[model samples]
Target: MRAATGLWRWRHNPLRRTTDLAEAWIAFAAAALLCVVVPLTGWAAGSSAHGSLQRAVRTQQEQRVPTTARVVRQADGPGSGPRTADTAGEERLRRSVVARWTAPDGSVRTGTVTTSRRQSAPGDTFPLWTDRSGHPVTPPMRAGTARAHALIAGLMAAMLTGLLVEIVRRLAVRRLVLTRYARLDRAWAATGPDWGRTGTGS
Candidate 1:
């Protein structure tokens, strides 16, 4: 905040180093950049995710259908179905049961389907999704889920932007400090040892 207000520009101050002014300016620049870059990064990431997810939702809706199926028997879900990640990048496991359903062709088909219930009884009706081949598959993605994915992407992008900004700020400050120290070292090398020796002149 002090840097944002240009306090280091007060020329009357006797305690200021060139490095101090340089760091102050750098701080101001870093703050300004953070304000702009963070939001821009988030928007870009969110928009890209939104577009991709929206497309996925449309595709799934186009190629799939929601239907009801009767549980043929209690069964274990496939251990290897498609894996989807949440915002935290955790894999969500799907539960399932053996079920039978009538397809678009009016023929009865039997297959394993994802289910929400931990225990299901045979002949109990449950919701399921079917692909073009009438085989049970994952449900179609919804717009709400797509929006959630976009939000997560945006937040992650914003956090990464903040991290980058901090790293750059630290590097800038370190560079200025090193430069100041080098200048001091050079000045001392030229004058420190010869101060009292006096050989040349007083």
Candidate 2:
């Protein structure tokens, strides 16, 4: 109903110009494409993202192994404890510490790791993640995280699809407007100097 009302000029208007009908059709078609293509594009993007992230999660879980990191040295600053306000008995702790852990290949890997343990001393153990190459890395992607990423990708795809459709509509309208102006100019030029010679009907 709303679409019909919007295109009424092109549907049943006797006074509508050719340019008006063309513009109306272009707008209508663009609107339709935007409604359909945008969602499909969004779905494709989201599905691809979800699938890729899921694969990454699987690979990470399969190849990577979890192990404990042994603290080799305390991180920079005061006590390796949580930050505190009172300086009397309270001490600043560095959550991050230099630690070493055995890699999947039995090689030892050492790096700074952030932990929640307070005042942890040398040889203290902390949980950490490592990749197949034995390099320390962040945790693997979770299903919820993948879904969130897919949502963001879907929104971006939808926006880009709509933007492209609008550009096409704008270009079509601009061409029609320019063509109409040119025709009007040519008609004015043909009759501008011939009005006074009406007596010479030839």
Candidate 3:
């Protein structure tokens, strides 16, 4: 805002330096890019990410099946400890249990599965996700989760775009300032020896 105001105010000002106009223009350009390019970049990134993730979700849903597995017994051994479920939705601690279930091919499959049920015992049935071959797999990604990830990706892209624009603007302004200083230094050097002389000027 200040930059835009200065640009308008200095347009016809007789005392406005070239560097001042350049700086104001740079600021205006940066602001314009921030207003236009940043949101567009973010939306593009998010839309792409969302499309890819939705495709993955569909593939996972088709390849994975949710089946009920009956617990045979608690699996307490050297390798069996409190662990996390393979599903992305389940992040809490779960107990390992020996369970049996039928595969998509109608074959009986028995294996060690992780469950959040603390009081798991024999014959306790719980939902489990498995591949077509009956091997346990993680649950499919939820739609809400995919959307949240897309939103985060969009936000990150937008912030990065804004940051890049600001960086370029600052670098250009810094260069202009340095050039202005160099010109001032040259002018000072040319007149330094003649300063305060009695007849330096007519």
Candidate 4:
């Protein structure tokens, strides 16, 4: 009887509910993890990956081309540019140039064709550019790398965590409702059937 009464009072009094507290705590924790921890860790990891790629590119370029050469004729613009013969009596220079980078899986990838006013002949060699720290600069500002992957992972984690937390809160609310209903059922069952009773009733 006491249990049923207590359950009934709890159901009626919204202030005594446990679901609200659980939901609030879950939301706060999730917000903190997403807005703070995840982004910081991802940023740190991405910076490291960027630095590593730069170093690797520089080392490879140095070993391949030890000396730099000057261009005699400027290359034409864009696609289908006319090729020019070298006045130095070397092989004709290629009008178009492509930059390549190796991925983590040891696969080589070529970037977009960059046509420079300075032409590069087939036999001519030039030192690849590097920053002060000897790191090759990757072109196409919008390109993705390991750093981007890390950031995307972080975002997915944040969203999943929020979803799980909300699910738990909903379950808690359902359990509370079920427990209250069960008590009400038991209370009504104990009262038994009440036939019509009154002084004037036949």
Candidate 5:
């Protein structure tokens, strides 16, 4: 609204200079882009990210297999201390155990995997996820998680677009202001010799 007011005030005023109109137009253009382009960019980015992430989710579901592993013994090694960090919050609290399971190819596989059982002993069982080759892998991404990632990507893209627009607007305005100042200086210099005599009827 302020930009509109400035534009209207400068539209036909006798004192309006070229720089004044240009500055007003720049402000209006910037406002328009912020209102229209920013949201569109965000939506496009989010949609693209959603499609890619969903495809990955589907691929993981197809390639991974779930099976029950019989615990062979408690895992004791450098990497088997404790699951302090995991994608699934509850899994982070689980203890690592060496377990054996049959692969999709019917071959026996053994690996260290996390289990929720507190007093796990040999022959005890826990659910596990592995690839067809029998290597342990993280579970597939959930739909909700994919959506969350897409949303974050969209927000970041929108913020970056806004910042770039703002920077361009500021630079253009600064250039216009500098040009206006230079013109003023030239006009003043041209009239300097007669500035004092104008009031003396010379």
Candidate 6:
């Protein structure tokens, strides 16, 4: 009998409605699932994108041919080298190779190619390289590192998950508050009219 009474009271109680509780629980569960799945999806997408970019860059580099080129001049850094220190007044000599080639339009163009890795005179003959697209190629750009991709993926997933959780939580709290307010209104209406009447003196 006590259990039955308790159940009856709970059903009509403004503080503990089944519908409100269920909504809150569902919201919590949905948020939890999103937090787990968003990161995994972001990581997979980032990995695939990074791999595709790297492959494209590699293919472009491989098409260029290695040619004999002159070392025009070495780019200088902040610190002077041992040779520079020893030579008080000797100017560093730079050498490079120049070649002329006709384009598809039959226009002759001259370009200089330099290689610092080789020790050669200014007039040394070397093959200049042209890429598959017939354009002079430079070094390929470096792709994003694994660590950078991972960090990006993590940040993206976190933002998505946080947004989803906040939205669900807000909706759930709103529903709970509305339901409680409705119950309070109904309870107030059930009170007898005499409860609000002022006392009359005979």
Misplaced by over 4 Å in model 2 are 1-3, 75-96, 102-120, 194-202
Ranking by lDDT: 3, 5, 1, 2, 6, 4
The parts of candidate 6 lying over 4 Å away from their true place are 1-15, 63-130, 134-138, 143-154, 190-202
Put down candidate 6 lDDT per residue, 45-127, tens digits, no spaces: 66666676677767756666444433343333311212333232332333334544443344544555443324655444544
**What's the TM-score of each model vs. the native?**
0.79, 0.75, 0.90, 0.35, 0.85, 0.47
Better of 5 and 6 by lDDT: 5
Cα-lDDT of candidate 2: 0.78
Clashes (candidate 2) = 1
Per-residue lDDT of 38 in model 6 = 65
Candidate 2 per-residue lDDT over residues 1-202, each given as its tens digit: 3444558845677877898888877877887888799999999999998899889888878876788889898777432222334322433332678888899889887776666687779988977777778776556668898889988999999999999999988998999999999998999899978867878985
Q: Local error of candidate 1 at 66, Å?
A: 0.9
- The positional error of residue 133 in candidate 5, measured at the CA in angstroms, is 1.4
Model 1 alpha-carbon drift over 4 Å, by segment: 7-18, 76-96, 194-202
> Per-residue alpha-carbon lDDT of model 4 for 67-101, expressed as tens digits?
22233333344322122343223223324454443
Lowest summed lDDT window (length 10), candidate 1: 85-94
Which wins on lDDT, candidate 4 or candidate 6?
6
The residue-level lDDT of candidate 2 at 109 comes to 77
How well does candidate 4 match the true structure in TM-score terms?
0.35
Indicate the residue-level lDDT of 56 in model 5. Answer: 98
Candidate 5, residues 35-90: lDDT per residue as tens digits?
A: 99999999999999999999999999999998889999988841232233463576
Clashes in model 4: which pairs? Answer: none
Winner on TM-score between 5 and 6 is: 5
All candidates in order of TM-score, best leading: 3, 5, 1, 2, 6, 4
